[model samples]
Target: MLPVKPFRQRTGYCGPASLKMVLDYFGIRKTEKELAVLSGATKKQGVQDGEGLVKAARSLGLKAALKDKATLADIRKYIKQEIPVIVNWFSVNEGHYSVVVDIDKENLYIKDPEWGYTRAMRLDTFMEVWFSIRGNVPSSKEDFNIRRLIAVEPHKPRRGRAKKK
Candidate 1:
């Protein structure tokens, strides 16, 4: 199970919060404030794009990649490998991000930072909401198109050297 961290109320911090969870899964400890700075998030605007997520993860020596128009199969493959994927989507007509931690035959398990817990949604409904955020036009609010995915690849820890005799 992925560690879930809820974004502070009234804070536009879903990106950093989601990133924190993924980092935590990899045993990387970082506070939300540190993650916010690493992700280039601001109070005036949340994570502007997936670039912030990719850069932040890479800064920590992790291989992070952003995939556009990602499919359900793609997410499942990552989860099967124990790599958590952050999905960008629109909820209530507003841009939102969540971590895809697990999946079943009919449902996708999401660790929603905004909601402060794990929520289950049918795969079809999840895809619809995920794909709905699309377009090139920019507005005051966050606008995104073609489902975006930030995959945090697993990194095997290197063993430390033993003391010399």
Candidate 2:
């Protein structure tokens, strides 16, 4: 499992808090206030979507991508690569952002910013929560689609050639 630090979200600062945890895991230090501005966070709305977090990561010299319709396998793949993924979860019309730190046979370990802790959710239960967005009902696992996924990674040098001294 990756060593990710959790920070409790301040009001609507879940997006920034989640991003801070992921960046901290990569050894990059950034304040939630800085991320809030880069992520377009507002006092009332916080962040509307993962795009803002993607932008914040990119602004920090990291590579970030925003994806929709993400799957459980996609999350697992990122976890296997030791990369933390930020996902938007919706519950009863309220949306929140959290980081996915590890995955096991039956549970997905999440670094939730709201609670500032690691929570284990069953694989099936995780999917069910994703489907809970907008009251969407999925007929099968294949039909599960997440609202947004922000994948961030530090920039890696090209492997084909070395830089001149």
Best by lDDT: 2
Residue ranges of candidate 2 with Cα displaced over 4 Å: 131-147, 157-165
Q: How do the residues 14-112 of candidate 1 rate in per-residue lDDT, one tens digit apiece?
A: 888888887776666788788889989876567878788789888988889899888888998878677778998878756677898888889998888
Report the Cα lDDT for candidate 1. 0.75
Per-residue CA lDDT of candidate 2, range 21-85, in tens? 98877777889899999999976778876778888889889999888878888888887777888
Clashes of 2: 0
Best model number under TM-score: 2
In model 1, where is the ten-residue run with the lowest total lDDT? 156-165
Off by over 4 Å in 1: 1-10, 132-143, 157-165
